[model samples]
Target chain A: MALKHSVSGFLADRYDMETATGFLRKQAGKRLPPHTSWLHVFGSLSLLLFISQTITGIMLLIYYRPTPDEAHKSIQYITAEVNYGWLYRQIHAWGATLMILAVVLHMTRTYFFGAYKKPRELTWVSGVLIFIVTITFGFTGYLLPWNQIAFWATTVGTESANKIPIIGEWLRYFIRGGDVVTGETLSRFFVVHVIILPWALTGLIAVHLFLMRATNLATLEPVGEEKPIEPKHGIPFFPVHVCKESIVAVLLLAVLVTLSVLAPWEIGEPADPLVTPEHIKPEWYFLPSYQLLKYFEGPYGAFFGIVACSVPFLLLFLWPFLDRGKHRHPKKRPIAVGIGLVGLIGALVLGYLGHVSETEQTFFGTRYHIDHYGVPHRVADKSRDEGE
Target chain B: MSNRFLGNTEMNEPTPQPTRRSFLDWVIGLFSAVTVGAMTIPALAYFWPAAKGGKGGDVEVKEAANLKPGESAIVQLQGKAAIVRRDASGLVAYSAVCTHLGCLVKWDGARKEFLCPCHAAVFDASGRVVSGPAPAPLPAYKVKEVSGKVFVSTT
Candidate 1:
């Protein structure tokens, strides 16, 4: 204690430690709105997942080779040979899915609570951009595994850019760093996934947090309304809100650990550009868009498909400006609630279709084959047909 | 010393030359632009796909005499998959990449066609799309028979 005091005193004499420390103390002890709920924990949970990803990603980089020839080999080496590498890899893989889930859930909660209003508009905009960055993180990271699914999925994913009129072809080439996905593409994705995205996300998250702090959490009160938080009356951020967040974090970690252990991610066959896997589907988060794109066909299909995929993001980014209403409660906003429900249901249905596309399934007594466009056709009953 | 300093200052102070300040600003701006361009140009160029990536000469598949009629061989040409088939007419070579989604196609001797396992896209012996979701046929490559050996041009 004496040594600690002396060191602190020495530093205090040289620097304005008192004010800096006091500011942090004040922030910690700040009173949160009385209406703060457990649902508010998702944003912090998303941050926790990002931290986990960063740690595991660094661990992975130790052994990961970005070259096409060695990328798969390196993954195999990490999974099979490196000490606790499998654990890190599994956590990183599972963390990405959970991070996206947490971000979506957080956004959903914010939307329902009508938090993205007036002072919180910039917060919502930053959050949406962060979501986009998070998705790019997933897309770029997916290819690092260098598996057949990654290869073909990337091929399909990048090919969507080919519909963009004048810039379409160049965009595809730029993305791939070539006419097709190759070693160059792997290198580009590696640099992007590892370096570019991490910095981008970190910067965006800082902006988002700064805005959140500046604006304060939106309450159930109407838009543009303010409730002065009384320190004694409101919940203290340090102990009360922190405790709730800790509990959620612990639960989320447990889920992540359980997932990592039980169903560890598999290192599939090395990417062979020549041979494509039979069922090449992207990660579940992209399924909705993937399935949506399949509905468009013919000369104008690509252009329209690009537009259709972009509509949701565009709407989401500008939602605050579009919905300039005073009411914060969903009960007061019937149309907004209805539209949200429709979008949610539509995405869920589309994701299901994407998952079940190009597969054979049995419904009741009949076997049906789901085709490329996710349309099901009844297969002839072999036994009955043969007997007849 | 004060008198001389004042005299020097008076001599230096001409009509406030706004052009000098503007010229200095322009110089700084030009220098900044040059510095940025020096970095930006190389960075932008770095992203462009290299002119040469895999070896671009003829890739020898095998001896022409060894590959029997009704048989096919899958080989790497210019680091891309290419299919070579031997028939009674001669040897024919085509890019193995499927037009539907860039999956490699397999030669099915039984079906006398190139079959893409993904999406079940099929291409006939002549590299024309036979069925399935493939919008275009497999691209054909030039095949040359030199003495007893067969070579596929991957340029």
Candidate 2:
């Protein structure tokens, strides 16, 4: 715990005070890489966003009731009575989206730079779990508002869960609290969103920091025999990097605050167990799954769902082993980078398809472009049939 | 500052480096266990507690004419459907049967309390706790008067 080094007494006697200060200063400078620039701000920005979520989440919990009978009412009270409560909710919602985006970008940067290699597989996979939890956080939190949209969206979730082979019924039964989205379901989701997920994320973050303390930051691998010059491109973690992180945090907070101010929050109709909502869509993240649900039928569709779910886990668990090639320069490992990019693009496309109305289902899935010349010749007929 | 340079350049220096280690790998390992834990904690808590009940409360019923003075009715609420009664002056509502171990509450015309002799969950005219462990008061119903007849709301 002492700040003093083990050999402090020996060094102090050997060198004059000024010379010793100079010697320590030289060593500290050598420890940092010169390329330590501002682009690294994203990670700090992410940390700051999460802190915002924690604060806003706690504040919202003070007013937002979790029971189905009262959840919607509590949200309304917060929006109308608690000054800035509306803003806080909006910030939490949209800030979550932004956090996911930031995380993805961070991961992409790491992947492209080959940050998931030896001694770093743990970090990469942890990041992947965080991604999964972040999305889950969005889903579980979505239904707490008790809006018609949230209610129906979660209905889709329950229905989807029911489609799973063995324990589907039990799973859906538990999630909806006795086969229906009632007060019990609302309370269950509240406990998950507020208490459970955050606790998990906090532990992951701690291990994430601990691991960083153990393994050196993965620098860009030497490009084509041009090895990274010594005294790599980084600064000491103390004043230089900490100062920058704090500034980045401030800027991120500024942006989030501005967005929260501009877009106030709102709650929809109080959930009535008797009324069935018209639109049944899950959270934005689940859009891909919801979209996939349309493409597969019976068992095959179920298998595809399983595959989609497993891919993230597979990549997270086996990434260190999968991309074990020595080349850390992204351009050199085009296959891995391309694979990651393709997966991302597919996810985005699927998410988009999930939101767009799917009137008709086909083996080819929803409508796709034949070079996308406005519309395909048979497309109008297909859509017409779907409408009918 | 811009995209001109690539790779892990410090956009914002996090802190002074005592050592040059990256924390990411540890985070990855931690994520797997934490994910499982996050899911399990809420789920275990769910099955532990019993399910909650609905709202709808109890009601009251008065007597037509007890032909006595200064006496009260012993009412029942939340047991064996719904029932009520009336003493000399005030109204009391209770189930004709008793709650404790399913005995019966005998209306004591002498003392004016619905006395469950089996468990002794004694109740006053209101069927409220005059004594003993009846987790709740007896289920009660309402009373109203017609043109010539006084009718009680049953069930």
Candidate 3:
């Protein structure tokens, strides 16, 4: 008892620990909506995946060489030689993909439940920014391995920035740090991936979480429905909500570990600027936008495709205002629900098309054939082999 | 007086002990704690830095004479497959990792080229992609022949 008293006294003297504990307890005691369930756990799961990615990424940075010549070689060393290095790298890689997936799930849940309306506009906007930051994280990290696919995909990915009207070329040069993808590009991506992205993402996520806690989670029931009267209707954030989130995080970790163990991440051949791969495709999450661009014809088409695809984010940002109804239920908002479904199906279909690339078409008297491997080869080119 | 402070007039009656609700909470709380601890430990260990060592030193593949003219032997070099071939020109060692995706490539004697089963990417005798999806030639390692013994260095 004396020792306990002394420890408490020390904490109080040094840090005024009682006040801090009271503040934390107040925050933790906040009551969540009674209707919260498994679906509500996705946002926390995304945060968990983000933390996992950051930890594993830091581990990889210990052995990862950022220069073009040594980047791929260093990855090989980490995967093949270092202790549990393969697991670390695989977790980081798969964590990125899973994080994006969880973000989508969370966003869809929010939108369908009309949680973005009123008092939560900033929260939704911040969530959209988080999504963009997450994808940008994926894009910048894709080039770090300095492998064939990483090089070519990054080249193509950044080239899209060139499709902008006036500042296009300048933006591309600024991103690449030169006219071409070189050592400069690798260093730039490494800095952005390791330093800039994590800091920005953490700031945005903090704001998002702050706004969420301040506003409180939306109930699953519509606004007109009666709020439960009993004290048990709502749950405290400390033990109840936190424990549920913990369960979800554990499940997510299990999936990630299985993926990391069963199919460890592999680094492709070292990047050779002189040789471009026959089939160059960006990571899976970028496929929808990639296919959307292919539908258009020329430089102008690329711009149009980009603008069209980006319209959804703009709409999503302004959704609270655009969807000016007080209803939180889906049935009451038929048009919004319809549009959301259409957008989801369109994205999935476009992603599929991008993956298969098995389209042969004659556009303006030119025969264009995209093989199954996403390799675009001209049918009229007699010099090329028939099989590819 | 105690009931007033407790915010429940029914507290004077009696608090339930070992109820089904409390038991379920304990079960779930224990399970969650165990599962989360299991996941977090490995994740934290992965973040802890270990000794950094190079895996690129020279490795003795096989006897020089075993890799005869027009014959190729797939040898493991630091956990990656490598092909040591003796052609009409000279002895050359190439990484047997397919340039397309890092799948281990196999030496097809009849075809006399390395074939990747993952994607049909073919590398010719000198590691150049003759046909298929491979983008670049297979990476070649420095080969040294000393007293009928062959060694390859990826460094």
Q: Per-residue lDDT tens digits of candidate 2, residues B47-137? A: 7435433233433333433414444333333222233444554443445443322334666667767766433457766666676534346
Q: List the residue pairs that clash in candidate 3.
A: none
The model with the greatest DockQ is: 1
lDDT of 1 at A306: 79
- Models 1 onward score TM values of 0.88, 0.60, 0.66
Off by over 4 Å in 1: A380-388, B1-19, B53-60, B63-70, B86-89, B107-115, B119-137, B153-155
Candidate 2 reaches a DockQ of: 0.01
In model 1, pairs of residues that clash are A274-B104
Off by over 4 Å in 3: A1-5, A220-230, A359-388, B1-155
Q: Give the TM-score, chain B only, in order for the candidates.
A: 0.75, 0.42, 0.61
Q: Taking the tens digit of each residue's C-alpha lDDT, what string does model 1 give over A1-388?
A: 9999999999999999989999899889888888898989999999999999999999999999999889999999998999998888999999999999999999999888888988899999999999999999999999999998899899888877877889988898899988788888898899999999999999999999999988778777896567788777788888999999999989988998899999999899999876767778889999999888767654576578779999999999999999998888889989888888898899999999999988899999789999877899998888999999
What's the TM for model 1?
Answer: 0.88
What TM-score does candidate 2 reach? 0.60
lDDT of 1 at B125: 92
lDDT of 3 by residue, B1-155 (tens): 44323333454467534555556666887999999999999996653333222378778876444877877777766645677878788788888766554455767778888876534578887788887656578998999878877789988
Residue B76 CA displacement from its true place in model 2, Å = 30
Q: What DockQ, between 0 and 1, does each candidate earn?
A: 0.33, 0.01, 0.02
- Binned by DockQ into CAPRI classes (incorrect, acceptable, medium, high), candidate 3 is incorrect
DockQ of 3: 0.02
